[model samples]
Target: MELLYSNILPLGCDDDERTIVGCFKEQMKNSDRVEIAVGYTSNASLNELDALIDRYAIKKICLTIGMYYIEGMPERSYHTALRVNQHWKASGIGEIRIVKPFKYHGKLFCFYKNEKPFSAIIGSANLGVIKLEATNRRQYEISALTINETEVAEIAFHIEQLKTSICSGNISDIKGMPLIRETNTSLDGIELVTAVPQSSVEFYKNCKTYVSFFLKLKVPRSVDRHIDDGKHYTKSNINVCYAAPRNKRKSRDWYETQLTVGSDIYRMEGYPNKNEPFFVVTDDGYWFKAHTTSDNNKQFSAVGDELIMGRWLKGRLVAAGIVKHVNDTALDADRLGMITEEMLEEYGCDSLLFKKTGQTALDEKGTDLDVWMLSFVSGNDYER
Candidate 1:
């Protein structure tokens, strides 16, 4: 039996970059060349690929560049493929082709020993600066590899056909590729509003009705050492259109993202999503904010500092707690082994804090903290 289809994302992502790149290195170690075809391409991504080719000393390389209609496509063609088109020729990479003016959007890779193909990868990921340079917690891509001889032959044949037909000259030799205007960054100076008033602890506690993004924003001790604030009212002015996990540049259209702490607004962008991205304190203690994943469906389990916040007050460090399903009967105050009566009195919290333990498990409900974290910030920074 042989492995057929395999996931490439977990290979390149998850702090295990060696797996994905190593896959190529291993292939290059045994093979003479690998072919890369992407409807969209960029210089930064190409540079990384070129480095790999050089390191393995893969003798032959070919590229098929195209202009696919996709979001995040570079605005200018020359700034993209055209510039890279000129850069690769000096190297041992001998084969390159440019295709455009057509709605071409496909990514393919074929690795070969001599001229025969042994492995190939195909998918929706564009070989662009964003994909090659950074691996976000999540991306707009899905790719897989097929090592079956039959599949590799079919892929190889397709590449040869593309070269004979659409692959005409380098990006510079092509006529239509042009320079275009640049798009502005959307994250700069954006506005957001709270979905519910900060005091409305019930809004965060009741996951069934609100089922919203759980945002953990840190308030500066200088700004509001909110040792005392209770839950209260609710309202929202903005809606979340997108979320940026820390990887791809955090640029979106107006009102695309919003993270809020007290009255301050922070744009969520180019950051990784973490399971436990909660409390963060700076060196001077002049500024601080809670961190949450870019997920849009997180709910808070009133386990921390809740006893201190009481019924109706506000302060920094007002609440600390675990995340859990509201209906999970195991989530009761007594079931929470960490909190004691004396501790609750000392913290001045009414409910026992439910700190998430290593033994904690994710709820079957779609309330993954990743979804809720982004929602929390976006809602608070949303517009009316």
Candidate 2:
């Protein structure tokens, strides 16, 4: 038996061999499969595991997450889990499941060779600990590795039991599970609300003093012809914002959502200046830091994060049954076809509206900025 502590050395000085990530990498050298049962996890952790699986040529990895069943998963994590599950399904790698009926808040990792359990790590570290950039605060996790045949087999058997049909279900099976609201706690002592308010009428009435602008989603005839040709404009204009070049090394599937503003729209005086980020509270209650980038400040994007804004817009379309949820196996052209002018028209809205809410909020950096409101409701009230 060997005890492992993640914070034995200073943060930067801690080498791979001194951390849980290092320990897992070492075990993977001789293992063909791994089983993980943890209370909680994040997309970043799954990404790390995905990289390790590829590097080690791991045949199979099964994860049974337990926290979502009891506390409810956040909207971001829920969507991410769905996308990753689809990706894994297409690649024939592994699957992620949620333990149900009762919460199982145990953390265990068992490694196997030749279908036999050879070693196991039992500890307090959730999978999130594997992500080096997950947090800035110092954290300490203590775990023990057991090479005893009997102990290793016992742990593996326990994980196998958790994976059974009676105990767990694939992530896709829980689509009806309520998603916990996402909030930003980065602001000093102030949490930014990210859940849509229940009543739209009441919200607008309360904030009567505001300025609004309607953004029509009209594709130029030339651009539409090019898209139809399946050449440079092969992807839907709606998805062009998400079509940025990804880092091949990281294998990231999404990019920071950017909505290109024309010169006419750019004339709006209150919009954030090029590279000057500000806070935006969506009519649906979600809030994110946004900035304008690129030539003529045409690209409007959420600061630092990729998933938030994309999920916000695309999720609504999915919920309305206007388009199918993203599938990893689908061709890029097919995925692009999912969001079209016809779908937006069917949904009763073909544009988005931005409004100045006549309010102010402090961003993550404690910079006081004007808080704007964004909406994509199905209506023509704001139409020119």
Candidate 3:
């Protein structure tokens, strides 16, 4: 389960401070219905919303506007609200309307993942762009997101109720209440973080985004001990050494390491330990703030230099198969036979120690432990 929190927005900073609206675009994916209750809004924010709705694949939208914001913005906020409502109505996409407001100072967004209420944002920021200004000119705002079932259900119902009570005009191609599901563990998914080479942007945008946590991790230092005489980093570095962060990068890291299967010790130039847990694939993601023994942050910068995960037979880590109904435990070779025949053949060898368990060799520290029972993806189907 991933819990993402946005840093408070100030001013004069674009990339550093996480925009509440911008982050919303990334969080809602494969969406069903999107609803926003904004105390104040504008055309710029609406244009950005239009792009976000398309990019995030939102099916339905609800905008609950507060008309009584500034004593009575009959000319300003009210007129703008009516104008915005017309745009949403013309699009043939969703429902929008003005609502009663006397100190209704709240900005909230609730949306679904797949067919259920999956995530929500409840915060102080409006659905409009904040101006970049110095200290005194900035209005401090903070908000919190909820993936929790009980809270999302309440928020969803609130949006729905607001629409029913005040929305005189409704706009929707799909005429119904938004899809809401009783919370289930299976519906949970993480926000994907990735880095694609500039040269491969189109390729990755189409093929590699989402599906897996893709990043470039360095080769295991123990690769030398696994293979007898063959030094993968020094010997077969060309095939394995790929540009990370992006294909345009000048310096590349040797990411691939040799694997041993049995007494025969199978080692191939391009073959990977397909069953490897992503924990062993690499230590850090495209960008990460690691936990210290204390609270200081450690960020890993633009270091993506390899293909990670995507469609079956077409990615660095190809979709192998899923192991459904397995108890949550650290993944190991003992559990390989339970998942799929392909998994057993591809990475079921005794050679797997760290990759299967997502830990270092005999790691008592348990740094990378995870509950195992999700779909598995790998480089090749059956050891290529």
Candidate 4:
């Protein structure tokens, strides 16, 4: 099946990235002309990726040109540890363009101007747990992948224009993409088309539609054998909403979306609804907040973290531990695995930690101390 648009859940996004990486690894073949470009919210890895590209025989590489330093953790080298530039050995990279940072409110965008114009397609996907994870049992995510030549060209040109402006330093009063922030534009030829979020309204719309889209797409699900927790399970007929609250950007006017289940058309502010046990997840960072009243007799709750558990927190849906801030620190896989196992145990999961012989390890300095592991020590764990 040729998907005109395929949703990409990029890596480093919650645990879902393992699924994306698995799928990508399964699909990526020996492409002589392949190019890999990535822009992350925090840092990235290039070493493990080198093996992937070499395994697939990818010919080109396009790594974003920005480095980040998480405050208070100077030894934390998450950004450069697994970088794309390090992947270029022997054959050397065909292109290396620096996508300078552009500001929008408090967010940053890596302007991809140089490469897209000559490309056959164009689209955007974010780098994070929500965008990347697969084992996350609670809420699901979707990426729109397109093969449209013209639409890709247009997007490429637009990026180029933005880049040109940035290069010339003529951006005195730069405004983001106005049309996306205002109206939803459909693609004409793109096979996998993902919309770029330019504002709160645009983000709301994407969340509303994309969640529905993935629900209908039927991407095959895999059994999640979480270490601490029991098998990660997903309940059918679920709904979720994540809104990035507005603090500096313009607020979304009171917009309402209606969700129809069976004979009832239930309405709420901004997001559309699904059946019973609907969960709303939002980054505490959004400008406008999403609210639902019990007036409709619908189940509701708000998840404040970027990485949220799907289903409900009661009865059928239980509380699973969250990956509060994986990006903020640097941890090896064993540390990540240990934390998962420990959390699973803490939350009544079935995984055995020290019992797994191959899993446990001593530090490089020969110390028995665990590496820079991170996770929820408790409720206030994600504050950093």
Candidate 5:
């Protein structure tokens, strides 16, 4: 037998932190696979959620935000979420797959693998704080329905594309697929449907008719707040904080500190060719902060002869002093300025600096074709 659950708990509803936590604690015990998918509002904390995953050895976690690995070795299983869908994009996770958010009255979906008496749910209840806990609110929302056989297949198919993206590194366009699609029988005596049933044509025309009449039928928005360090800020409480503190050091300074701590450092910046932007990278992106600029006046000036990060040039490092040369003659010099510069050459690898386009105005008086065009014509020869 299948069970269904749904609700109308919007973003600003209540401020309770544990209702959803309790829900997870209760539902997760017997759950072989637990998927916590949230849209406009998020209920679970990254740490608490990850702990749940660890406790249950969850097979999959599809969050709207990029999921983190708070404890154990990264799960071999795929964890997929949208890049712009929510926050926490800087964690450097490998399987950070992108997804789109569902809309209000948009069939919300969750797929739990391994838990029998298949219990599927949809509604306004988000797994988060205000939606479940806060009081002195005008209304609260909740909805849920146990699934019949067909609904099971439908929900399974709804999230299959999401599962494929995490496991195989591919995602399909949601628009191409219907909200509910028929699935072949897998579990006994149950027809399956998509976990997120698309708003029926009738529902689309008039959402209020299908959604619960008890709750005020209006779309809710997440209160805007600053996300500093790793903490999430909401409007109701100005002082909310997270487990991790923000690194106050500027990103570049932190990067430099990590790389120069151990070895003498050197930097080089210039385009190897006209098409490439000048780049400054450390032995590994792990060490020095890399930067790129298109200014032609930024030239290479070094006293050392080492080639670092797959390119040749001159710059200072905190550990190593100024590089003197990029050739055999100047090689013996300590090259170890406070920031030393030595070329640790290796094959099949390059520095952490990735590619990006930079902009500079076109010159008008030089011998270059752009300059010549500008001198000869009425329009600016816009070339760099």
Candidate 6:
């Protein structure tokens, strides 16, 4: 048995081997599967674990999260977990489960080799201890690493008990659970902006320079037939941008999200130019750098990173509870993966409105750029 303390030394000087993340990685080196039961966790922690899973060639990870039964999980975290589970499920990697009926505050991680428990970490650290972010403050945690065969088996048994159908349920089960509708709204790191009410005629009257377009385009029934007729079909515009093609050879697929703009709209005086990046503050308070590119400057996308724009728009819908969260594994036939006309209609709005705020802000590189506001609120009726 070995004791581990996260803050034995000064903040940044602590030994990486003693920290939760480092300890987990070291254990993963000898194990192919792991089972974790933590009081609470975050999306960042899951992302960290996901990376480790690939790096270590982990075959499976079974996570049983507690605390959500007492204090509802944050909507973002819940949705992120769902998306992560979807990926894992599609890949036959693992599953994430939630405790039920009673609250469990224990934190334990058991690593297995060839389906036999070999080691375990019992501690005070939640899954968040693994995330190494600049903004996250280091937390003090005391845990024990035990390789004793008897102790490892005992701890593994407890976790297995928690996995029983009666004791816990898969993350997907929450969707049908009565308490699933209750989600904590305390979104950390995300700014929530109060949108100008669409019913406010005065606000619309004063906003004349705005451009609005539908999120889901009306696609012809047969794209192949259309191509046969010499029509160029850009799948990026028809489907949600986040699911952009993974074809490395095609420059169009390189841009994750591409929404086609009308020539008149793209040619608007003072609008952003081709490849000229600008800051965008969405009505939902998400901010990103954006630019117009492609032939005729008709493709609007987030500057540099491709997933930013799609995440912003799709994330908003997920938060609104109007759409299900999805990942790259989501198929085109999975309506949950793509923004469909039906989703927009259910959201009570079919288009997004973009208007230059007439403001300027310095980007990460310290370049001054125009700031634009994007609104996708329901009932918003904007003129072309």
lDDT of 2 at 296: 84
Off by over 4 Å in 3: 1-19, 67-70, 74-83, 101-103, 129-137, 166-384
Model 1 misplacement above 4 A: 1-22, 68-77, 129-137, 165-167, 183-384
Which digits, one per residue and each the tens of the lDDT, describe model 4 over residues 1-384?
A: 111223343323453333433334443442344333334332223444455557766555443322221111111123122233433633585332333354321111111223332222222333332233343323333333333556545544444453343532211122221110111111212222222333632333233122121011111122222222322221111211111224335321111111212222233232333322221222211221112235553422222321122211110112122222222111222222212233333332221111001112243345342111111112222222
- In angstroms, how far off is 31's CA in candidate 2? 0.5
User: Estimated TM-score per prediction?
Assistant: 0.40, 0.56, 0.37, 0.28, 0.30, 0.53
Q: Compared with the true structure, what per-residue lDDT tens digits does model 1 show for residues 205-230? A: 33332222223422122222222232
Query: Which of the two candidates, 3 or 6, achieves a greater lDDT against the reference?
Result: 6
lDDT of candidate 5 over 1-384, digit per residue (tens): 322232344543244332333444665665655443433332223435555556766554554322222111111111112221122223221222324332212233454655433555555545442233353133454545445657756665554555454422222222221111112122123221112222322222222221110101111122222323443322111111111224533111111111111011122232232222222221111111122222332222111211222122122111111122223212223322111111211010112222222212222233221100000000121111
lDDT of each: 0.41, 0.68, 0.40, 0.27, 0.28, 0.67
Could you give candidate 6's per-residue lDDT for residues 147-259 as a string of tens digits? 99999999999999999988888887663322232231222243322233434423433545544333433333332312222333324463533233346443232214457
RMSD of each: 20.7, 11.6, 22.4, 24.0, 23.0, 11.4
Ranked candidates (TM-score, high to low): 2, 6, 1, 3, 5, 4
What lDDT is obtained when candidate 3 is compared to the true structure?
0.40
Regions more than 4 Å wrong, model 6: 7-17, 176-315, 318-384
Error of 3 at 84 (Å): 3.9
TM-score of 3: 0.37
Give candidate 5's error at residue 263 in angstroms.
16
- Choose the strongest candidate by TM-score: 2
Clashes of each: 47, 1, 8, 45, 63, 0
Measured by TM-score, how close is model 2 to the native structure?
0.56
Q: Quick one: ranking by lDDT, best first? A: 2, 6, 1, 3, 5, 4
